[model samples]
Target: MTFQDYFPIWNKLQTDQQDRIRSNLNFRTVKKGTILHNGDMDCTGLLLVKAGQLRAYILSDEGREITIYRLFDRDLCLFSASCIMRSIQFEVTIQAEKDTDLWVIPAEVYQDIMETSAPVANYTNELMASRFSEVMWLMEQVMWKSLDKRVAAFLLEEASIEGSSVLKITHEAIANHLGTHREVITRMLRYFQSEGMVRLSRGMVRLLDEDRLRQLQD
Candidate 1:
């Protein structure tokens, strides 16, 4: 498939507009752990994932990391082209969470097209709004939800994403996602084990009671 196949408004674009985007599109493959965009310093173009996963996160002054949102197959990430969005003030880092295939549309080229195309501008604004909504939801989760509930929710979300009860993720990784510490996650996992909610082994956490975990998350 091509970018047109994944982009919803591709057919609405004029021939020249389509040609300009096609000419500037870049196909890329990245390995897991590769940092594609480094905060606000690198204005890496808009990324459209063809396969695998990408994680968008922000780091605090003290170096703590919290995930803002994740991009899966067919997902379009607009924040990578932060320079195009003048309203975006904070820095965000994007990394490959798995071996990934994607296409990047050059920011300058896309911005130029947006200036002449109302449809493209509208689509870009909608995408930006959706990303901000996800960030707002994460803030609410962190503010009002307890650690145990957050952990349970994360585990369940991971299970659904990976299509399994056993999650191959480390305590430190979970802490990084939730913006907490390794020791705190370890303590919470031990408590979950005591309650027979999960079974931990080395770098894995296997869900034992899905119903109980869902209840706790609620």
Candidate 2:
């Protein structure tokens, strides 16, 4: 993809500034299972995924890996905006779940891009705002909704994200994402499977009847 395709703000930059950013951007391909960044590591440049998938998670105090989010093709791998702005260490780990192409742009340079490119700045602001809204919504869900409802919502969201009814995930991973026990998740999955909402196969869960799942949530 051209720099403009990835960086819409490229247009806002002067010819020279745009050239500099293009020159500075470094591209790398991370293989599946590669650990891109770790918690407590220095938060550096922005990572733009050109292709493939990534999972971002935080280490709980009890040594659990609590997945915070997932990143797909063309998505930005963000950890802490505050840390990036302050140029400090990050508190999340980012791992490539599939072979991924990524563009790395230094944090300082991104700040410059935002400063010079109104379009790029606006895009960044929108990204942060959407993330904030999602977190707030998740917080409310965890506080007010039942675990069953949360699981249903999460499954639906994940299905939408993957753009398919079949979920290629393991029970342990689901438990990690939900901050719950694996057995609990397994039992819940069995219940859903029995209810004909999902079909559990070897290492995957296929959402069979979404309407039923939504009804259960209600």
Candidate 3:
């Protein structure tokens, strides 16, 4: 769905309010594999993903990439609450997973909207709460769950959002998301494929036996 379509809060805006937003919003197109912003950079604005997928991650001192979250179409991205409260730089790097179209709302404009529009403020609160919930859930899973369980959870999340069983994703990306090594992801994927739970190719994975995959998690 388009940004304006999925973001139902926007529909509640008055014409003048919409005009104000349009005035500050900027649209841009990015090719696949583009890094939109890096961790520890100055917070500039909210990135609204209109189309395509984007991944955000943190790099550890040991240079390991830990996937924090993914921003798909209709998602609004902002600096983490910790970063914003402390006036620190961003905590994650954002990268486009495919050719992407985006609408950027400057920080000042976003703040103004939040102050002036109840709908916009409510939207922001809901988005932040969701992000916080996901973060907590991921932390719990990483600490208590098996790798297979983690993979199953990730696949289910992706499939739920994409509305499809086939996922066009890379092994390295999955590894980063799981905070593991690429070799480990490759091996796990092979095992899953051999078990007829999934089909893997160069850059795509298809869930062939989702029931079996879930059972593996169990």
Candidate 4:
């Protein structure tokens, strides 16, 4: 798809502004596990996902990673250019969760356009607000939700996303996404298996009773 196709506000900008963006945008392909942005300071620019999956996460002082949000095809990522929003300072890291294709708009170029284009500025604010809401929701989950319910919700969500009950994901990976330890995930999985809600093997968890899982989540 063309840049215009992916960008919802393409027609909102003036022709010159559109030209500036088109000229400055770059196409990049990243392998799964590639780190696209490392920290708060690197102004890697805004990422527009063309295909595949991406993850946005933060690290604890002890060096454990926890996912904040995930991106799929046609998603726009503003945190990659967090420098543009001077007030907020978060040590967020973005990585390719699957082999992906993306469009990178230089931070300076996009910022410049935002200065003169009301639509661009408004669109940016909307994106930033949406991201902040996700972060807030995550904080609520981590603080108030039980791990078992969280795990069940995550499993059901993953199953929906992959369109399968057999999840080809490791315990450690689930821990990383949920911001817990591998041992915790393993213990929980074992508990679920014993209850017949799931059947766990080397690197997969098959849902035996999704209704039970959903009930637990509820």
Candidate 5:
């Protein structure tokens, strides 16, 4: 799909505006685990995921990383163009979780359009609100949800996304996603194994009782 197809407000934009956007777009294919944008330092522009997965995360003072959200096919990530949103103070890092094909619009060009185009500006604001809501939900989960429940919920979610009960993920990776320690995740997995919820071997975790995991998460 072209930039016009990926942008939600393409029809709302004028011919000149559309032309500008098409001209400024940068298309790239990145390998898995590639860092597209590193925190607040790079205004990598608005990212439109044509295919594959991307993760938006933040790093703590102690160097731990926690994912804010994941972007999949057809998702528009406004936070990548963070330079345009002066009010957003925190830094966010964008990384490809799988081989990805994406389009990036230069921050200045998008900001310029947002300034002159009501449809673009409104869309941008609404998108930012949605992203913030996701972040707020994550914060609530961290604060109120127990680690066991969180772990179970994360497992269920991963299973759903991957479409398999057998997950090829390591305890360290799971810990990074949950903002916890590897030892903690290992212990939790061991407990789950004992309860017949899962069977773990090396970096693989196979679900034995997904219904129990769902109930536990609730």
Candidate 6:
């Protein structure tokens, strides 16, 4: 599929604008663990995911990492083009969670189009609002929810995303995502294991009781 297939306002753009975008678009295929965009210093352009998964995360001063959001097939990531949005001060890192195919529209070209096209500017604003809403929801979760509940919710969410009950992930990875220490996650997993909610193995955690986990999340 092409950028026209995923971009909602593509049909509204002028012929010349569309031609410029199509000509300048950069297609990339990255392996898992590849860092696509690092901090605010890099303007990596707007990424449109064609396949696989991408993760948007932030790192604390002491080196703790926490996921802000995730992107799947057909997802549009505007944060990668942070140079065009001067108001965004914090650094957000974009990485390939799995082997990914994507198309990137250059920030300068997109900004120029937005300057002339009201529809493009409006659409960009709407997208930014939606992303900010997701970030706000995450902040609420972090502030109001307990750690156990947060871990349970994260596991359920991960299972749904992967479409499996058995998760092939390490405690350290989970801690990194949740912005906590590895020992804390290990202890929580042990508690969950004792309660018969999960079974922990070498580098995996199997959900034995989804109902209980769901209850904890609620």
Count clashes in each candidate, considering only residues at least 3 apart in sequence or on different chains: 0, 0, 0, 0, 0, 0
- Model 1, 121-209: lDDT tens digits are 99988988999999999999999999999999999999999999999999999999999999999999999999999999999999999
In the range 1-218, model 4's lDDT, one tens digit per residue, is 78799998999999999898988889999999999998987889999999989999999998788899999998999999989889877788999989999999999999999999899999999988999999999999999999999999999989998899999999999999999999999999999999999999999999999999999998
**Tens digit of per-residue lDDT, candidate 6, span 15-95:** 999999999999999999999999899999999999999999999999999989999998899999999999999999999
Clashing pairs in 6: none
Question: For model 2, how does the per-residue alpha-carbon lDDT over 127-213 read when each residue is reduced to its tens digit?
Answer: 877756766665677688988887898899889888999999998878878777889989999999998899999789999999988
Q: Tell how far residue 29 is off in model 6, in angstroms.
A: 0.4
- What order do candidates take by lDDT, descending? 6, 1, 4, 5, 3, 2
Greater-lDDT candidate between 2 and 4? 4
Candidate 1 residue 54 Cα shift, in angstroms, is 0.5
Residue pairs of candidate 1 with colliding backbone atoms: none
Name the runs in model 6 displaced over 4 angstroms: none
Candidate 3 least-lDDT 10 residues: 80-89
* Candidate 1 vs 2: which has more lDDT: 1
Runs in model 4 deviating more than 4 A are none
Global lDDT of each candidate: 0.94, 0.77, 0.78, 0.93, 0.93, 0.95
RMSD of 2: 2.7
Model 3: lDDT to the true structure: 0.78
lDDT, model 2: 0.77
Query: Where is model 2 more than 4 Å wrong at Cα?
Result: 80-82, 87-90, 115-122
Q: Mind giving the per-residue lDDT tens digits that candidate 5 earns over 1-218?
A: 67678777899999998899888789999999999998777999999999999999998999888989999998999888888888889899999999999999899999999999999989988988999999999999999999999999999999999999999999999998989899999999999999999999988999999999999999
* Steric clash pairs (candidate 2): none
Q: Candidate 3: list runs displaced more than 4 Å.
A: 1-7, 11-17, 80-90, 155-168, 199-208
Q: What lDDT does model 4 reach?
A: 0.93
Give residue 80's lDDT in candidate 1 (0 to 100). 93
Model 6 per-residue lDDT at 135:
90
